[model samples]
Target chain A: GAGVSQSPSNKVTEKGKDVELRCDPISGHTALYWYRQRLGQGLEFLIYFQGNSAPDKSGLPSDRFSAERTGESVSTLTIQRTQQEDSAVYLCASSFFRGVQETQYFGPGTRLLVL
Target chain B: DQQVKQNSPSLSVQEGRISILNCDYTNSMFDYFLWYKKYPAEGPTFLISISSIKDKNEDGRFTVFLNKSAKHLSLHIVPSQPGDSAVYFCAASARVFGNEKLTFGTGTRLTIIP
Candidate 1:
């Protein structure tokens, strides 16, 4: 079976520009999550989706950051008016519908550099 | 305040030796703990996990030990191999049920010298 995949392995954009990152979860995975990894830091939770229920946006840093997942397949994270501080690796993960304790499989991640 | 802490930024061990990585958390409500291994340019992969009910869990050469009283946990890799060299992260969640939040500690880079 194929693993989770992300597009645009590397993205370099000017500050204040908007960028969108995409994620494709593994087949049959019903839980998806997004996280940010800043340099020299641990993974920070961003957002999560479970099936058709309302997505968990509690971890989103600001209103400028938003994500939408269509059904249980793919998700897109959009950052509006990006700042230099937003530069980091964006990771997406998926797991079986067994709840938070279930093991999650991660994608390679998309590295965003705000110049 | 950082909920989870990995005081050691790095560790070095000789190949075929035992390697120990430690982590501590301030939140007493956490019930599940996990360890992840990551390489440069890649996302973290789940290594092993332990629930609050169990003090220790082992998988092949990897073992995770949890001390509830001390609010601490450690991952032990016996006979460390060069391929195990990477950043190891410790994470904890308050609940094992639905919609639980995971708090992660700063990773510890492990270097295995052959």
Candidate 2:
């Protein structure tokens, strides 16, 4: 089966620019998550979307970070006014969301560089 | 503050030897723990997990042990192979709080030397 996929494996953007990262979750998956890993750091949760429920944006660092998922399919994470601190690998994950402890499958991720 | 912590940044183990990665959490609310492995240029893949109800859970060469009182957990790989060389991340979630989002520890890079 095809796994989660992300676009633009690598992106180089200037400071103050905006970048959009896309994620295609596995078919039938109802839960999608966005995370970012900074250099020498762990993966940080950014946002989460489950089915038609309201998205969880508590983990988003700032207002510049936002994500949208239509139904249970594709999702896009947008970072407005990118900054040097935002340079990281943006990762996407999806799960079946069976109301239990479900394993999250991840994508290859998009490495963003802000200069 | 980091809710989960992987003190060791890296570890090297001889092939066919036991490899142990440790993790600690500051949030007692966390009741579900998971381990993930990742290679270069890739995202993490689910490895193994242990629920707070159980002290240990084993699957093939991988075993996860939890110490709820200590707020600690460990992933043990027996007879480590070269293919096991990669970054291992420990994550925790608090289902009781109705939060499925995971809190991850800084990964531990494992190097299996053949």
Worst 10 residues of 1 chain A by lDDT: A48-57
Model 2 chain B: weakest 10-residue lDDT segment is: B93-102
Error of 2 at B67 (Å): 0.8
Please give, for residues B24-75, the per-residue lDDT of candidate 1 as tens digits. 9999989999999999998899999999999999999999999999999999
TM-score of each: 0.96, 0.97
Candidate 1 clash pair list? none
| lDDT string, candidate 2, B1-114, tens digits | 999999999999999999999999999889889999999999999999888899999999999999888999999999899999999999998877454788899999999999
| Count of backbone collisions within predicted model 1 | 0
DockQ per candidate? 0.77, 0.85
Q: Which regions of candidate 1 are displaced past 4 Å?
A: none
Off by over 4 Å in 2: none
Clashes of each: 0, 0
Classified by CAPRI criteria, candidate 2 counts as high
